[model samples]
Target: MANISMTETVLQCHPMSEKGFVDAIAVHVDRAEGGRLQIKYTLHGLVDGIDFPEVAQPKRTDELWKDTCFELFCGRADDRSYVEFNFAPSGQWAAYAFTGYREGMTELACAPPQIKCTAGEGIFEMTVTVDLPESLRALDVMAGFSAVIADKHGRTAYWALAHPPGKADFHHKDCFALQLEARSAA
Candidate 1:
């Protein structure tokens, strides 16, 4: 393959529930050749109070979604299949594959994701890069980026691209906010 050309997308996810804890959440996604994707999240709000889970060993762990974490969903537009990646500030990650909406979920065999995190007075930023699984490497793909934030008082909020009418379902088709096209070789 030729040198991969990268494209960046910036997305602002609105809170699906409580909105008071956050002023804004920005998600940036960059895709390049060979299905390498990088996602960055910046949160501005009362960051100090939130509970960010930390693992003793800083390894991949399930249920990162329960606390403050960033998420990414990617799949072929028509396949009804996708992989969900979760990143936590505590240097933990999780990857899961699904056949359909909330169905046939299984742990995805993926290499460890590269994650970096930093925090300021009222801001927090995190970035993660992962290689898409062979099954999801396609000429075109759809993506949904989201987050779950927990406040100091243990109140949780959901943020997503386009929330479903009834609830916050990032896996829902409506939430696939971005489409990525394969880059041509130079």
Candidate 2:
């Protein structure tokens, strides 16, 4: 028997002294039966004043980080291996694997994830579901959820689970604040 031990969590943006265009960003993560991880991100505030990209295909795209996009960094503490996932409101997505700190970049082979995005009344929402990698299917994992938001004023801000004491580096170790426990065998 397989066990389902997934919980939905709403994540908050890393606090900073200075405020940006977005008043709030909500990132939610949960695991579904059959080894899938669902991630939803909602941007609330003056969305009309934000500069969001305009793409409609859910196909893989490069350089999405240059604009407004939500991202998740996942890895296990036991090893330096990790994966970076990028989801755009324009329905674009990408996944990359790293052997170590920015070394050996490989485009991960993955099925097209389900994604949806909508915006109205100062709110923008995006949802995506990706299959858990074979390596992480039955092990504890930590993840860092972040977003790059651009404002109508041409200013961009970085949001994450935790921002280290220097520049806004989403890959920093401290950013991995959320943890998911492994499922037990039945």
Candidate 3:
């Protein structure tokens, strides 16, 4: 198993003036044997100023990124194909398979992820766990963690482990910076 915790994420620049509503974003990743992955996203700052989606029945959904959402991306080191997962605070989620960087995208059919969200004084958090698609289960993997944060004031900020120059492109190859070795058979 491999465990990783990200240092504070970098907030991408936006056209609107920033109020610094959110102070920090941190992501913790745990990759277990047999393709089980768990991720925890923690946001520290003024929780009331951040807008989160309303809770709904947990199901597969699209466009979760339009609000406050946590995302995960992973792929086999030897293949161009990759997978992206979006986890909304509302318990809805989305998964997609991509042939390459921003190429060929289709909804990925898999077991629904287990998502848990909590809010408290000055902090917000979401935890999600899912099984990796069968194709990616036995290979070395590269992964990226990111989030889309929307303030109640209609302003949004992009947060990622690393950002490509110019704009916030989570699909860029550079964002896949973490390396995880394949788990060997017992």
RMSD of each: 2.2, 2.3, 3.1
lDDT of 2 by residue, 1-112 (tens): 5565545444455555235667778777776455578878888888898888887867999889998899988899877888888888888989988897678889988877
Put down candidate 1 lDDT per residue, 19-126, tens digits, no spaces. Answer: 677777887776676778877888888888878776456577999888888888888887888889888888888999999988999999988888888889999889
- Taking all chains together, each candidate's TM-score versus the true structure is 0.89, 0.89, 0.88
Total clashes, candidate 3?
A: 0
List model 3 lDDT by residue over 140-184, tens digit each. 788888888899989788877777776788888777777766665
How many clashes (backbone N, Cα, C below 3 Å) per candidate?
0, 0, 0
Off by over 4 Å in 1: 1-16
The residue pairs that clash in candidate 1, if any, are none
Q: How close is candidate 1 to the true structure, as a TM-score?
A: 0.89
Candidate 2 clashing pairs?
none
lDDT on C-alpha atoms for all candidate structures: 0.79, 0.79, 0.81
Off by over 4 Å in 3: 1-19
- Measured with C-alpha atoms, the lDDT of residue 181 in candidate 1 is 68
